[model samples]
Target: MRSKARTQILFFLAASAGVTMFGMYHVLEALGYIAPPRPFGDSIGTVAFGVDIALGVLALALLPSAIHHDPMEVEYGYVGPPSALVACLVILSVWMVSVLAAPAGAIVLISLSARLSLYWTVPAVCASLMSALVYQLTHSPADPNISWSTVLGSVVLTLVLIAMGSVRGLVLRRQAERAKQAKQARQAQSPQQTQSAG
Candidate 1:
């Protein structure tokens, strides 16, 4: 598959995972096994969450267009570092607000043509902290004797899944890059061959 399609597929899968995690956390919380997480700031905080959701939705909408159009095709202010910064901030804000809604959005931004220079390692670290914070802040164990094994296991499992996804995504990206280079090479050769034949 083309890189664009692969990216879309990965985003969809990641989004599903995020939503599932959010749902599971809520269910577990209701069952008294986990603590209840709160919204942003109470009443106004909900607006921030709304913004987060909106940004995610926007990213989803933009990914398809990114496939066909060069993200840098625009004039001044339309592409570059500023845009990348905005994209990252929007994604990070989404994660800050709702854990389950950030994946697809983040992936969308990453796949864009903005050419963000930020390394993925930093965000990976942030993700680790985000998950841990959510778990700790929302703990609601009825028994004080409960061990942290379950939490640790869940975290480890999540990391493993993320690693697998990242590897898969990287493979897809490399294939796409190679394909692009091959096509360019062929185009370059075709004109020379035509001239020589003429």
Candidate 2:
């Protein structure tokens, strides 16, 4: 798709997700399920929603550059697709390791891709671990109920997010590769065409 069209679609999706999350935050507050952000009259959480929207918009704006200057496409070919799929597996693995490991190694290594998948998976892993710790500590020390179902569901969510991110990166990478290859072909054929014309 053309850059403008892709930008519009991305912006729309981002706006939709922002609106939904923002609404959920409010609904949680209204139901007294989630405590609001602190301070006399501050709405930090709501502001965070706006920030998310803004970041999405910014990303949509920068999408062209990301496509045009993609390193994975230029240097490694269509690495994005496999990289994206690997990302999902990594997210699930990281979460599991984070929960079970005394000192997690996945988190440290995954940090290298903070710009790709770690940005969200990192926080999800932290939240899951923190939640598990709370649940483990609150119950009888010997008979803690860190429900397997809850952990499984969280792991699944992170895995899905990772997949989505990977696919997105792959799409951009493919575009960059196509552009680069086409540029090279034009350069290669130019000399042959000139020789033939002479």
Candidate 3:
């Protein structure tokens, strides 16, 4: 059970990191630092900034899970119902995969998920669809040569995910070993206890 919890935490952390990187890429785009880039309109740039902060906060929220045994044991309680949780996971998963396909829309998905209101789920879904549509409309023919900064950002993001995964794997392994040892000790003591009782 503990190991299962640890695995969840690790996956959460990796997802958060991936989303944050996606968000940062948007931030950079808004700041006029990258390619296939557009002039930063005030409204969209502000939205992008808000999206970046929201993602960073989401990432920070997972910090407690790193130290605590069970994330659900936290005081605030779980995010929402199992269905909502599943939706968020699905949304996040799709965005993570988008890093390879449509990197532009990754931030949109994270921003939508951060809203977290059950009522907003449908709107968020629609917004994501619209955002992707706009992105595709803007850049239909994909460029083979992406900006160097964008390339560097992707590499860094990949490294962060890789490192987090390694740590999470180690935690799960240790948890399994401990559980196995405890089980073996219990088995070893059972025969002795039985003999003494006899």
Candidate 4:
């Protein structure tokens, strides 16, 4: 159990680091700190970008599995509103710092809400709203008009990613349930067989 916990913590840390690096890279690029690829290096740049995106997606997808509680440890009940509220606050705080931190905030919320409950939707919605709010606040008035499409896209993407995490949680929950039922059936059969033999 100790070894398993250590492995989970390590996996969570690694995924978090990868996600942070991926988010920061794009933030820097958006701020013009990282130049676009030159004509000669375009293909190379595209490949690198694709790899980064793949890593980011993989990290997000694995996050629920990495942090999921053991079936025996999980309490079978709905998580209350307070838990959802705290998750929303955490995501809001992260987004307040920078809209570019949306991915990081999503990760935090997803990890928090990835369980067999409806609580995931609360933080998911909050994160999406915060993304749009931060974008509006950060956009300069003098800059070209705010692109509503960009805001909408961000909101949609945030919801989609978090929904994916929720789905993962649901799948894990179902598998655990099936395993528990099978174990119970085996135990029942064993007792009956012993009685018949005696």
**How accurate locally, in lDDT, is each candidate?**
0.49, 0.45, 0.45, 0.55
lDDT (10s digit) by residue, model 3, range 10-101: 55655666566766776676576865224435665565456445544453343333222333422223333444344443443333223322
| Candidate 4 lDDT tens digits, 78-172 | 44345434544544444423423335456555555565455556655665676566545543323445667777876776667667767766776
TM-score of each: 0.45, 0.41, 0.37, 0.58
Ten residues in sequence with the least summed lDDT for candidate 1 = 109-118
Q: What TM value does model 2 have? A: 0.41
lDDT of 2 by residue, 36-55 (tens): 43432345555644543453
lDDT of 4: 0.55
lDDT of candidate 1 vs native? Answer: 0.49
lDDT of 2: 0.45
Listed per model in order, the count of residue pairs whose N, CA or C atoms clash below 3 Å is 2, 1, 0, 0
Ordered from best to worst lDDT, the candidate numbers read: 4, 1, 2, 3
Candidate 4's TM-score: 0.58
Best by TM-score: 4
Off by over 4 Å in 1: 1-118, 141-147
lDDT tens readout by residue for model 1, 54-138: 6446644443443233444233233333444444444543453455655654454344322322354345435544544553444
**Runs of candidate 4 exceeding 4 Å displacement:** 1-76, 80-88, 92-103, 139-145
